[model samples]
Target: MDRQFSDRVEAGRVLAAHLEHLKDRSDLLVLGLPRGGVPVAKEVASALGAPLDVLVVRKLGAPGQPELAIGAIASGGVQVLSRDLIEQLHVSASRLATEIEKQLKELDRRERQYRGDRPFPDLEGKTLLVIDDGLATGSTMEAAVRALRQHEPRAIIVAVPVAPSHVSSSLLSAADEFIAVERPQSFMAVGQFYRRFDQTSDEEVREILAAHTHSGE
Candidate 1:
């Protein structure tokens, strides 16, 4: 049985319901994985009275199979690669280096475009809630957790609307807490759980962030 929501807003609202108990946590911050995670994060932040920010993670796609992530990189040059995958796929050292450089450039470009001059929130001793629309491959989410761990947050929680049971289980070990609205046995793709899985544009992301900034001030 495949249950789909009306849109990201609905998913956010639903996911937020699961996190309502954390509303009173003063040191909580929400970081979304753009460009799909911002809108969802906004709703979560609004509901929880937590500040919202973006966590840009660029996937280092495998050679030829671009969708398959050989490795992933997050902001501040946090990189994680699967050595087994690299060895099995026979990815050359030079080729891996090239992809990493490309991903780093993209990570920086996205940070500038989406969050120009906005300093990353200080996660030290804060309960950081990392939100995304959904999880697939789980590599990107793992990379995000790894990057955030560098900041020494008091706790880390990975929350999403939907993810495969297996992927969600694997991700639990990476974060202090992992919560998802639904973990189906036959999870196919993230889009399958959303009726409106439209590609979020950069302009939309900018608008949302700007609106939040203005409202907060």
Candidate 2:
């Protein structure tokens, strides 16, 4: 209920402590879920001395309730839907198609805006640490994990500052390992845990990635 972190940067530092074992592992790679996740992940990558990259994912929220995710789409055309939610909502096929198309366009635009000419990092046989500011539904993270699976990462670890205690089972099953700094029972939203939860912009995401890339060079 109380503010657990001053901001995403602080959250990342706290998470890095718990993930200290992964520090300096050549096989490890840190992939952040942009745009909010990038700042947190930047700290994690710095702490771990690993390469950092972004995994673009868009949440497909339910009709009329944009905050409630019905599914998610990730890079490389990987899509994951909650069939139960879809059936329960009775979301029309046309509506779902339109949403998916819209999100896919946004994903593509983000990829171009963030990475520019740089190619996506290779994940084959690597240990991936998927970082996010926090998790609420876990749908977007699940989509990211499924997409990464196609590249055959040796392992996938989903790391976040906070998440609902109830989403643990699903996230754990989705990733090889899942770590949450705080799993509160009374979790309402991810932003509530932070004292300053400002929206992360596309420009910020680009700058962070550029800085990380330069530091690596």
Candidate 3:
């Protein structure tokens, strides 16, 4: 049977339930991928009594297929590329460079928008819970985990509401832990499992982070 969620909020609540065992840990912090992931991460942060923040990442799409991720770049100049996919698609060296440069501009724009002058928290020896609304290609989260590793975190746990079982297995080796509320056998898109799959806005992301910050202090 397919499991459907009413919305991201509901998905977050359900995801949080699975994370209850890790609650109240002194070194825990939640980092949400902006736009869609913040709301879901907010709930988990609340459940675990952990501080929340944003980790901006930009997908480097194939030249013509904007929806197809060739790779991704993260806030700290960290990038993860799919060499096999790039070669299969015949993406030229120059073309890949052009695409990466374009996405890096957008990545910087988002980093400033969400973070202002605030520095990323010290993540060394911290148990970081990185949340996203869900995974499709998993490139974005992979970039995030690799970037986060530079900070020497004790562990990186990638959590999501839904993902295909194969996609879930592919990302396992990248993180210390991976958790999802639903890993269905048959999956199309992440939105298909939700009743309300609206695009999350920048203002909403800001509000969620602001609210959590105020409450935490």
lDDT of each: 0.87, 0.91, 0.87
Residue 98 CA displacement from its true place in model 2, Å:
2.7
Question: lDDT per residue, candidate 1, 19-73, as tens digits?
Answer: 9989968899888899898889999988998888888988888999988887788
Tens digits of per-residue lDDT, candidate 2, 1-217, equal 4547999999999999999999999999999999899999999999999999999988898999988888888765668888999999999999999999999999999999999999887789999999999998887788788778888899999999999889989988889999999989898899999999999999999999999999882
Better of 1 and 2 by TM-score: 1
Pairs with steric clashes in candidate 1: none
Give the 10-residue window scoring lowest on summed lDDT in candidate 3. 111-120
- List the candidates' TM-scores in order: 0.90, 0.88, 0.88
**Where does model 3 exceed 4 Å of error?**
65-70, 81-94
Return the clash pairs for model 3, or none: none
Best-matching candidate per lDDT: 2
**Top TM-score hit:** 1
Candidate 3 lDDT, tens digit per residue, 99-160? 99998888888887777687768888999999999988787787788778878899999999
